[model samples]
Target chain A: MNEHSLTAEIIAILRKAPSVALFSHVSPDGDCLGSMLAIGLALESLGKTVTFFNPDPVPAGLTFLPGAERVQQVLPQPKPQTLVFVDCTDLRRVSLTPDYLRDSIVVNIDHHISNQRFGHFNWVDDQASACAEIVLSLINQLGVTINRDIATNLYTAIVTDSGCFQYSNTTANTHRLTAELIEVGLNLALIHHNIFDQKPLAQVKLLQAALNTLELRAGGRLAVMSLTLEDFQKSGAQQELSEGLVNHARSIQGVEVAVLLKEVGPQEIKIGLRSNLWLNVNEIAAQFGGGGHKRAAGCTLNVSLAEAKQGVCQAIEEGLEIGRDH
Target chain B: MNEHSLTAEIIAILRKAPSVALFSHVSPDGDCLGSMLAIGLALESLGKTVTFFNPDPVPAGLTFLPGAERVQQVLPQPKPQTLVFVDCTDLRRVSLTPDYLRDSIVVNIDHHISNQRFGHFNWVDDQASACAEIVLSLINQLGVTINRDIATNLYTAIVTDSGCFQYSNTTANTHRLTAELIEVGLNLALIHHNIFDQKPLAQVKLLQAALNTLELRAGGRLAVMSLTLEDFQKSGAQQELSEGLVNHARSIQGVEVAVLLKEVGPQEIKIGLRSNLWLNVNEIAAQFGGGGHKRAAGCTLNVSLAEAKQGVCQAIEEGLEIGRDH
Candidate 1:
């Protein structure tokens, strides 16, 4: 079915459901949480009972999102007949057992191209920058006015996923949808502050420690930054706080490949790979039993930090060399 | 006159002009350069002879902009009859004397609220997120079809000035204009890379050195990060590379006031101030013989870096106390 008709059918299904349970992916990002909450708020306004669930706690920076408090960590007893999975590539992404979905009419809404279409009704739009874009369309079709709260949720989703409209996923429709969200009286200044500006002190300290280990190799074609366990402990930062440190290395001028190795355990290192233009980091990552997209990928090494660094750097060097011949 | 009629009048004026000279402000940023180039490209399409001038050289990152090579440093001996200033707040901002303007029909196009309107024809839309927005409208009115080159220029202007659409100045119109620009087939990914991702290695090193000096005071509300002359030397970075370091301090979670003190010379320190929520930083800055907007400001002190830090910290503490009483 065409997207327009599919959207109509999803809206019809949602309208007829007495109660809907919305689930977000594990370690939920702004896109997932915001997408789930936006749709949940819209359904509630339509006089339907809505329950929101996420396997992990919402990140501190995203707590300001309206309806965030309502997202429970544990699933409620007697699961609703209708289940909606928002921003999940598949059921496993939510870290929930598939048994519950057996009897429920599953509706999947996501923007990931890899979505498995696990839902009885799936609306997967890789072209949409964020699932919030799809949710916004659904809300409009549901005849629910996008209030400040709904607008805030949807706006946050789009901004975070689109890297504030810097990512390649951002399209003309992303900006148009943002324009509509801004028209709904969303306090963009405050939203931007709460979402992006409010970085934890620990994260900043972690970044400092990570930058201290910056190394450039492969004739400036490869940049590497790593944070040992001691670095994390000294900064009072959790492992997850090092999420975007690889981007720092990736952003350096003249660097084609950026690598970030995190000493997560005594003999275990986590590796992140990012390539700017030519080198395929995913291919390098897959060699280490990790895989993702062409530009970004990751792997885990059950070796010392030094060994992991040496191995990854050598692989990246080879990758860069191969890229040059092309 | 209303903006519509003013835009129409300016379009009419440009349509009739035989030749035009475009000027950008000193220390040109993406917005000023992009705005100038976009207009220049559009005028060239109209078969009007166009010349671009800037008092300063275009920054290395902005050199990728189309027609960037054409931005001349010195004003031509015989200036074009029609001289247009793009993104200049005042005539002096271009850093050229008014002597050149005496014989030319000056057209002032800008988005700054403080625009002096020093033009026989002026279109200063303070509401615009970027001067490029105004230029985009002018180009459209001039009946120029926005190709990839013009679109890239305008897109860069909007993206940079809007802080990638995170700033408060961004409006529905900003995003709407961006939607139109994206439809013109501009490569969003490459543009983002050129504008933001390609940080100089020296700048990254400077950031590392600055972050090492991060200190919290006034119950963690005031965060200060300073860089000594030695720090700059060690990083091999220039003073201009420290431009956004203050924002690192400002982005801390509990930081209401953030300051970056750069030891520019012996016994000379440059102070940048940014306030997150309340605390009027401009007021604090003015106490030290510097001033800007409420949330952001700057100052210079002839005292030692230590003395400067102490004085600024005390003033910001008092400002925060005053903010609390309100």
Candidate 2:
């Protein structure tokens, strides 16, 4: 079926359901949480009983999102007959057992290319920069007026996933949808502040420690940065604060691949890989038994930080050599 | 007159002109350069002779912008009868004497609230997020099809001035205009790369040095970061490389006022100040013989770095205290 027809059918199914349980992916980001809350709020306005669930706690920076307090960590008792999964590639992404789908009429909405279509009714639009874009369309078709709260959630989702409209996934449709959200009286200044300007001092200290270890290799095509356990303890930063540090490496001029190695334990190191134009980091991560998208990926190694760094550097150099030959 | 009629009049004037000269403000930014180039390209398509002028050289990162090479730093030998000023608040902003306006039919196009309307024809739309927003409308009215080159320039202008659409000046119209530009077959991924991802390694080292001096005071409401002359020498970074170091201080959670002090010479320090919300940084800056907008301002201190930091801190604390009582 065409996208419009599928959307109509999903809307019909949602309208008829008496109650719905909305689930977001584990380690919920602004896209999943905002997508879930936006649709859940719309469903509630339609007089349907709605419950929101996420396997992990919302990140501290995103806790101010509208309806964020309603997202419970535990699964709802007496599971609703209808279930909606937002921004999830598959059921496992939500950390739920397959039994949850046994009797429920599952509806999946996502923008990931890897979505497995685990839902009885799936509306997967990989063209969308964020699943919230799809949810905005759904809300419009359901005849719900987008208020400030809904607009805030939808705008945050789009900005987060699209890197504030800097990513390749951002299309004309993304900006048009954002325009619509802005027209709904969204306080963009406050939203941008709440989402982006709340970095802790510890996070800055952690970044300082990370930058001190910056190294360039392979004719400046690969940039590497590492953070030892002592760096974390001295900076007083948690592991999650290490997020986005690899971007600093990837942003360097002429660098095709950027890697960040973090010592999580005495013998375990976490590796994050990012690429600019080419050189799929996912394939390199797969060699280490980990994987993600073409541009970003991650892996874990049961070795010391130095050993993991050496191994990843060798693998990345080989990959660059192959790319150059091609 | 209303905006539409004024725009129409300006279009009529441009359509009749034999030749045009475009001028950008000193220390040209993306909005000025992009706006000037977009209009110049459109006029060239219409078979009108066009020349571009800037008082300063284009920044290295922006050299890839379409028609960037054509921006001459010196005044044209034979000035065109029609002279256009883009993204300039006043005639002096172009670093040219008012004599240039003596005989020419001056056209002033800008979005700054302080624009002096120094042109026989002026279109200063303060509501515009970027001067390019106004230029886009003018190009459309001039019956010029937005090709990839023109679209690329206009998109850069909008993105840079809007802080990638994160700033408060961005409106529904900004995104709507950007959507039109994207539809013209612009390569957004490459544009984003050229504009944001080409950070020099020295800039990162400079950022590391600045972050090392990070300090929070006034109960975390004030964040101060300083970089000494020795820090610059150690990082091997120039003065301009300190452009965004203040932002690192501003992004910290609970920081209302963020300050960066860069020691340029013996007993000479440059001060950059940014406020997140309430405090009028412009007022504070004026008291120190410097002035700018409310949210961002700058000044130079003849005192030592320690004295500069102490004076600014005391002034900011008083400002914060006053804001609290209000």
Q: Mark the 10 consecutive residues where model 2 chain A has the least summed lDDT.
A: A317-326
Best by TM-score: 1
| Candidate 2 C-alpha lDDT tens digits along A163-275 | 89988889999999999999998888788888889998888998999988999999999999999999999989999999998999999988999999999889889999999
Residue pair clashes in candidate 1: none
Every model's DockQ: 0.85, 0.80
Per-residue lDDT value at B213 in model 1? 91
Error of 2 at B321 (Å): 5.3
Off by over 4 Å in 1: A287-289
Residue B266's C-alpha lDDT in candidate 1?
97
Q: Model 1, range A1-326, lDDT digits (tens) per residue?
A: 88788888888999999899999998889999999999999999989999999999998889999999999998967788999999999878888777878888999999899999988889998999999999999899899999999999999999999988888899999999999999988888889889878888999999998898899999988999999999989989988888888899999998888999999999999999998887888889999999998999999999999999999999888877777675
Residue pairs in clash, model 2: none
